[model samples]
Target: MAEKTGNAFDLNLFKRLLKFTRPYKLVFYFVAIAAILLSGLAVVRPLILQNIIDRAIIPKEEELLLYFVSLMLVALVAEVIFQFLFVYFANWLGQHVIRDIRIKLFNHMVGFKKQYFDKSAVGRLVTRAVSDIETIASIFSEGLFMIISDLLKMIVILGYMFYQSWRLTLFVLLVLPLILYATRVFQKKMKAAFEEVRTQVSNLNSFVQERITGMKIVQLFTREEKEYTNFKQINEKHKKGWIRTVWYNSIFFPIAEMSSSITIGLIVWFGGLQAAQGGVITLGIVVAFIELSQMLFRPLRQIADKFNTLQMGMVAANRVFAILDTKSAIQNNGTIKLEQVEGNIQFNNVRFSYIEAEEVLKGVTMNVNAGETIAIVGATGAGKSTIVNLLSRFYEINSGSILIDGTDIKDIELKSLRSHIALVLQDVFLFADTILNNITLGDPSISEEDVKQAAKEIGIHDFIMSLPNNYLYNVKERGAMLSSGQRQLISFLRAYVTNPGVLILDEATSSVDSYSEQLIQQATEKITEGRTSIVIAHRLATIRNADKIIVMDAGQIVEQGNHQELLQIEGGYYRNLYEVQFVSGIE
Candidate 1:
């Protein structure tokens, strides 16, 4: 594993962020044009005010003053119209960019190697997808618009002020050095606070999600009081995070406001003195300088704050991009399609290890003829399930080759390999949907007749029919409405309907009751006929009739033969397991 790096808000991150909006460049161009035109009105209206004071109002020319005032009104209206267009387009671009980012993140996550998911928590990934993305979206919309408009307004106003009277402009800008220094200090502190807030939000979201998903466990243990205490602690952390952010923000505005007040006061006092001494400062000049003074500090303040927003956004982008950068350890080889398969499988010197130093399968070789039923029994963590995962290409083998019909499984396309195989996992996962949907998952195009036949074959059709809505009855999330046996039966039907050439049953019968297990055993015997099957079980009696049984211990096969052959060795683990069950029955 690579060491984690904490370069969350680096310059390169901004470059990557720009790439997301590259597709919508035209929208950005339109927004920029509208912003410039709107900001130009800011400079123009102030000059119009100067004209009224110097040429019309001071000379007692009401008619001329009214004329210039009307022009100012027209400029203001135009500015409002352009402002509306700018806002609409900026928001549209922001939302579309966010949509693209989410789609990219989702596609990347699903394609990630199983190892990434094994190491990452579900709640953390969920928060990255939702809360983190939303934070970046806010920066895209509000932050971008404010920064651009403010920058343009400040630039144009400063140029106008300088052209009118440099002396007055200098007076207003006297506080510039202090403001810059203060802004830098505040922005750094604010960014740190914002980062803390972002982390706390994710933690709170993750806690809530875990509580809801594990509500049953909580209720079973009656830990509602404990859970509430945990929630309160997490919530308090979030509260403190926000309070720190507010503390930083609250102190910023007052300093900027004070500077603006001092600037305004200085301009009025100094400019008045200059005008009294028959200097170039006029009432109109003073008014324009004061107006432009406000324009200068507003954008300056925004520029400071925008940097903080960009910092938060960069942290979010780092997480999102980190997911996007992950490469899947297992990837499709060539496009190998099995239009027709004989179900023959061969494992040649197969070796696998989940971790580097620990070997799970060590140079084991086996070959199964087409349509053969093979059972693999082993102690827990003996790599029985690992072999099945390899067959499905869920995890790549460390060193070995798995062949289907004499062709290496890696040579075959992953989609084709998986499509030809069906897996009935021990833990049945049903969606929050109707029973029909769950059964039809294996083959959505299956006909009603086929569905009914598959269901009846698993001996579940009658039970399903007894329900209030039969197939349409909702299963609830995770199939909570049904017993464990019913869920297993439904899973069996799903696999049976697929009619796959290769079938893997990994503890598929463990959850079913004895009666249901008998029915399942019978149904599965018929289903595995003329099809390759790999059965894994802990129960000693479940795989007794298997064509071959391979017993494993400590990642190597210790026994391989028929059930009677294994039983002949009375002291072996399999024999011991069977005898223990036999003795328990006598009691």
Candidate 2:
């Protein structure tokens, strides 16, 4: 959640949110006109009731009474129709506006650099895009224009009340300052309370999302009771935040309600007394004043509740706009799109960091010749994966340059640069979708036959065919239905179908069984043939046959040569690393 300073009702944020209504200006006007019509029509029935009491009922004129009754019925029906229009159009406008904002927000989020996502919680972003956006929609549906309508109705009724009898209206006015004072206090308190509630909602959402996604870890460690206790605390805090807002509403509305009821009592006592004492005030005026008093005070009471809606909307808008205003997007300024890239890649003394405090890649330099297979062997934080991520433009390099085919990657169009590369990560993610769709990812350019051919070339076709639905089998969420090695193979097939010029396997064979390793090794050789490949691995045996092997440690390349040449160096980094892995069978 984004923190906004100053007023809780942010006028500037409200204006920015309303800018989405530009495309639907006509609908906006229609909703506004309906509100105006509603406000004016609200006074119609009271005026008719006054006429019936004074002109017909007082003189025992039954026909005249029926006439005024019919007139009142007409006014009621008109009020109903316009009220329907006001609500329906207001909601319709809100839906369309949120549709645009949601699309824009999702598009902006997708373009952000990987580091931004690395630091932010997925649950909070989901809240911004989904539920928080829904909160802002209420601004249009029930906040701004509706508040305007209610205030307008109160003004018209108050004006009528004064015209009828200023003496009686003065009593109503006497109690208004108290209503206004309580409403102001309530609005301010609720504003802060709602912000707290929203923050807690985001906290709850994040906790639930992470725990559910990592349920296997919790159950594996047998920490269910501990996590349950944590959730209970968070949920209880959320309840307390909401109850504070409820407590304010409980205090304020009754104060408002009591003031209105007292005003009505005063009008009855004062107006009835004057009518009996032979003053200008009549029974008809008293009746009209009673109806008019509710019309005046009810909206004054609701204005506070409407301010709650407005305050919530401002908070939601602040958070959403914060996402929209992020400068974390990759600066994709390159216009050069290469139809065929030669796959030669170079990193020239690159220095990069996801955060300022720690540099993940420190002045590292390397080269991969076109059609050469290079292996990077290093410890966990050796910057092996960082090299590939920078090459893929997933994160921007802080210093130095990366070039593809002798051209600076920053000058190569991002789509074009990425189109020439295929990456199969260690932790393969598959959507809950059919195997074929996962491979093609719904790309129309890649036909089903093309997928099958690529799968067969990688030698995983027979394994896939053995399944019940073959290529059509649903892999379930994160490929949960598939074994670890099986998911890796699917990722390979997906990368292969793209037919990229460069291939990257980031520890692709480290976590699989021996049989799957052999299968993956075969697939690797098939895909890397005549293509530039950067293989990151902890298993030293897998990359022994590469054209070159680069040894990295602590974010720097310490050694590089062919495997036999590096092994020939006395107690070299590669030799030492190979010895440890060979002896222990794990890195």
Candidate 3:
């Protein structure tokens, strides 16, 4: 990413943001036309006021006065209509553009590689998708189009001021150079401040989100005071960032107001002298000049404020585009499809790492025939889980190949490959939803009957039915309402309902009570009966009946055999692991 600088307007970034509006170009153009018409109408009101004061009122002609008054009313009504159109269309365009961009950003994020998320902050991404995108919408609703309309209004008013009396116009413009210089300095300062504010907002969001998500850890460690102090520091930084913008505004606006006041004073003093000196200055012209001068300076003040909005929006666009532009590390170039895979899996000299030069899986080779059950046993960080992760293609292997039915998994289409496999992780994650919905996961094709059947097969139907709402019972967030055992049962039902050809249970029974483990083992047997199953378990007792047992140590397979055959080999890795677990009962 390029370093952010103090540029009030980034043309390239603005142009890129405009591409999202292309689909709504007709509405966008209509908004533009409305802005122009509104500016024209703004000038007409001042002219009508000038005509009434100079021609109709001063002449004491009641008929002409009524006629001019009627004309002025018509102009005022027309201005109101155009103003409504301007506000309505500008906001309408902004909403449509933001909707399109938000969808695009979401789609881009969904396709990002797992590695990208590994290093990214969830809170920061949420801020980009929600808060930052909202800021971009203001670039149209309250920034770009508003600024343009104000500028056009100012130009039309200036033209009228000069037309009325050049001498008075010159006097009124004397204080403008000071205002212009102040505006330039203000823009540069506010741009830097707004950028800092955005960064701090994102930081504050990240800190709060992470702390809340891990609140249990905070309470367990009794670190609430420490986390609160840290949060205060982040919030203070955010406060300071916003205060800087306020400070600039506090300084700039008063200067602008004082300059505007001085200009009005100069116009009255000079125009009065011209009238006394027998020049062509009239009461109506002087009155019109006052209105025109206010019109001219009002937009100048607003431009400074609107320009700040525009700058903040450009900064937000830069952050969002940064995510959109990132390329996923895992490429999906395979086109091959499978009607049904036989579930024969092979890992041929597979070597992999989550990070470079920090190998997690060394050159490992393994094979399983169709419909066989294989259990992988290992200590923590011994690459047992990594093996299953590679099988699912969640992360790419560093060397060699992983294959199903003798075809390299890299050659298989990602969606089709993943469709045949179901993974039940040790840490079960259930959405805040009903039991039936959690099991089916919003898959319309998976009927409620199918879910109930799957739950019955897994021995969880009675437990679910014991609840007040039965299958309709809500699990709440991350299944907090359910016990660890209940959540595991739900996950099993979910995996079973999918009817996957291959099942992966990654330490699924390790965290549950003995009764829950028995139930899980029963569910495991039914699910793994006709499928190729790979179970990664730290509890050695859970995999005793495996058709084949593979012992892993330090990212390499050290032993391979059935449970009894491995236990017979004295001091073998599998024997040692089994003795350490079942004999000591410390697992």
- TM-scores for every predicted model: 0.93, 0.98, 0.97
Give the alpha carbon lDDT tens digit for every residue of 196-288 in model 1: 887888788878988998998999999999999999999999999889878887888899999999999999999988877878888887887
lDDT of 2 at 402: 94
Candidate 2 ranges with C-alpha deviation above 4 Å? 1-3, 583-587
66-164 in candidate 3: lDDT tens per residue?
888898889889888888888888888888888898999998888777778999999999999999999998999989999999988878877877888
Query: After aligning candidate 3 to the native by TM-score, how far in Å is the CA of 467 from where it should be?
Result: 1.6
lDDT of each: 0.82, 0.90, 0.89
Q: Estimate, for each residue in 1-587, the C-alpha lDDT of model 2 and write its tens digit.
A: 24586575776777788899999999999998888888899888888998898899989999999999999989988899998889998989988988899999999999999989999999999999999999888888998889999988988888888888899989989998999889888888988899899999999999999999999999999989999999999999999999999999889888888988898899889999999998999888998888888888788778889889988988888989999999888899999998987788888999998878689888988888999999999889889999999999999988999999899999988888898899999999999999999999988999999999999899999999998799999999999999999999999999999989999999999889888888899999999998899999988888999999999998899999999999999989999888888876655
Each model's backbone clash number: 1, 0, 0
TM-score ranking, high to low: 2, 3, 1
